[model samples]
Target chain A: MVSAQPAGFGHDTRHELIRFENVSKTFELSDRTVRAVENVNLSVARGEFVVLVGPSGCGKSTLLNMAAGLFHPTSGEVYYNGSLVDGYNLKTGYMTQNDHLLPWRDVVGNISTPLEIRGLARGTREARVEQLIDLVGLQGFERSYPSQLSGGMRKRTALARLLAYDPETLLLDEPFAALDAQLRLNMQIELLRISRSLNKTILFVTHDLDEAVALSDRSVVFSPRPGHIRHIADTPLPRDRNLTTLRHDPLYTRMTAELWDLIMPTLQETRGEAS
Target chain B: MTNAEIGYAPASDEKVAEDRKRRMDKARQARTRERVKLNLIRLLMIGGFFALWEFASGRLIAPFFISAPSAIFRRLGGWIWSGDIFYHMGITATEACAGLLLGSVFGIVVGTILGRRPFLARLLDPIITTFYSLPKVALAPLFILWIGIGMDMKITFTAAIVFFLVFLNTYTGVRNVSRELISILYLMGANEMQVLRRVVLPSAITWVFAGLRISVPYSLIGAIVGELMASNKGLGALLVRAQGEFDTAGVFAALVAIMVLAVIFNTAVRLLERRLMPWKSAEQELEGAV
Candidate 1:
């Protein structure tokens, strides 16, 4: 909503932030053993928007979860900042599909939860939480509970919560998948603007090819279950590009279409190769 | 598609959506009304039964085995005014209250210690459950022998009843908390105590409330049963004395007093629950009034 520098955000320079070295995950169910991810070697760079796209049960989410330190890899190591992640840390903020805001907490309280967890002084935390409320365009509804807000508003509140801690890296799990088509586009534009201003590294998981191309600097496509990389594509779109200019980019359509094509074959292959 | 053709489909979709929403609203209203009606009927039925008891004992039936509601009230009034009921009520209340508080504290501490440590939970779960399952009434003689037949026996019995119910419920509640919620909190830089304080405790509140509701009744039952086994002053002792002397009216009166105490305690606890959980009402509504 406010003007910010655009040129400085567009650089394609990469710095290694997180690296996955031959990571694999296996889950044991009552009657079956499922390998959710398999030898997935991937790395996310600082200040880069990395989107992981695939179909259902693609292990894309599993791979992301491992990177988030939600699950331990069965075989390999995930190094963040050149060190293996031991347990959960505040340095990486994860926003799940469901906005896990406590019902008892109002918008301001929810947004400041990370700060509260860190045990920041009440006065400083309150001031920063108010700033976040304004930053997210949620000024008037600071006192509203999650139940009282609309779908888009709740997502914004959750995003605000993620941003309040100002984590070095952000992990999003299909954050806008629940919104309507029009609202999803609006949110995409807003997310780009915020991400640009913050210059934070983000790893986003999504099913929509258009979303991946429109939002991410590079897209990693996963194969099927026990997911491995099918292909990785880099988009030429600038970091400051919003939904309007992103859709109008000459290379945008081709990038999205190519990703769709790459993923479609895997979907079909997985189905056929299964029972 | 032209605007004219597209227009009708969208319009119909909107109307259908609106109709469904209206129907849903009506259904919610109907359900709320039914809940209110059920509560009112329950209250009226209780009152009506009391009135019928008064009428039967006073007029048609002989007031021998079953005392009239009016007679019980008059007897209660005399006992209270003459300060005779006060000592007995005080003894039972003190034993029940003391036992409940101490037992609940121990139960929560033990339950929490076991719940967080999975290996410990596994090792001690069977033993704890076995103790819980053993007939509580059978423990009365053991408690009497150990505590020597005074208020200590009553308190021990009450404690025994309150402890297991609370321990089992709290243990399950702690176990039932979502692992994801814990991880999220941990990632937010919460320490172990904070995770337990903010996440586990709040998640367990509803179950703890349920356990409290159940244990309060057990507290009263335990005290009364202990008194029945051996006590000189309590409603249970009064009932035993009345039965030995064939004072059926006195027995009925003592039972009625116990029921009244239970109803009052439950009502107070329900009020406390409502105060503690203002968020639960909104959450339930979002779950579609079910």
Candidate 2:
């Protein structure tokens, strides 16, 4: 990683990058209306790592989609940098479970895609792509296509691509959900190291409570369907703390237990309704 | 590791390399044997069919109905020596290639625009369907009436036949490009043009190439049939001429020439496919329908 300089993109004294004000989303399917999320109000500050945690189909992902401006809130507004995200907020980089790393392109081409889109000078774009390739530890696999690479390697390519253009915020939807346990842990640690050093505001959506505890400045736990905030707990773990040893920390265990208690009742209640 | 580290022995590593090479050589030999067996089977089938036909040509069945392979090859050789087959072949190839290239360009451009704009796609859907439903041979009389019996008329007919196929395939391909991929680009500060260039076109190109491969034989059919109907220049005209003279061997030779030409055109397309889409193998391309 070429030493990340936050001064390059020019962030002033403003703190808030994303703010969801009473945001509610209702999806109109063919047979039924799906109220994905209801009245979710949360603000993510600049350089903050916020993880949205919940059970599956709990609309945590819907909120991330809202922040990315893929879809608007049906009721209230979602804002970025004090402006309403009317359509396709161009300031964010999004990565989902599937790498979407264009099977046609090799790794270098995929990472350099955003830079090419922005029409950066060829030499500068090449240099940045080179730096990103190193950042994601994909140096030797630069010429390898996504289909040829392993799952973990493809995810790394996608991450390198997301960082190539240097978006102010990253919207990740369980980006490592498909990986094996050890690979997922390694990716999590690497992501934390990069995002922390680069000062990226990340809103990561995950169903795993352990992951939420491991990688966030604050954890916003959501209820079951028609998800709204169940609790917003500040992790307050040291940024430089080693994740491999962090589970031993009493604060980490206590917070995980507390968040678990908050989520269990909602899960049981939903299951009871289903039964 | 202890012995190698202490004494800097290269023998163990050399032995590992030799074992790997031997395994690779055995696999290569197996692959070659399989391919040779397949080719031998193909050869046997083709040769057996031809030998049976040759034996029956004059003895059981009348040679006039189904000429012997030897007689057909002799006629083909004479035509080659006289240099008439080359003329017909050149004219047919030119018309087919010209029509294919022109039709594909129009199909890709039109299909892309309509695929991107659903409103326009819907507005013109009925007319496009009607055009597609119309038969290629039926339009020959009208094409002759409009442009007359030159090479242009044949090329136009071929292009028209090719346009609809290429257009439909390209339209379906472009429409089915992953929404997630497009949205990701949009979020990455890509404009509509950038998104199309970066994602839509590349994604849809596999479809475009499929259409092109399908259009190759159809283009040849278009030119040959048009020549058969009116023109004096192509292999189709040579077939018509042989039929008029009641020369069974000549007709058989011309048919064989057409078959060879078809094979050549198809091979060209496969080669071009390999060049254009290095990322995908021929079999791998047929996936991603959704």
Q: Which stretches of candidate 1 lie above 4 Å from their native place?
A: A1-14, A139-144, A273-275, B1-44, B54-62, B285-290
lDDT of 2 by residue, B106-200 (tens): 99999999999999999999999988888989999999999999999999999998998899889999999999999998888888999898899
Residues A1-275 of candidate 2 have per-residue lDDT tens digits of: 12211121222235888888878899999999999998777888889898988877889889989998899899999989989998898889899998898878888999989889888999999999998876666666777667556677788889889888789899999999997776676678778877888898999998888899999988887888888877788886887767777789999999899889988988897887678
What is the DockQ score of candidate 2, to 2 decimals? 0.36
In Å, residue B288's CA in model 2 sits off its true spot by: 17
RMSD of each: 6.8, 7.0
Superpose all Cα atoms of candidate 2 onto the true structure and report the RMSD in Å to 1 decimal.
7.0
lDDT of 1 at A110: 82
**lDDT minimum window of 10 residues, candidate 1 chain B:** B1-10
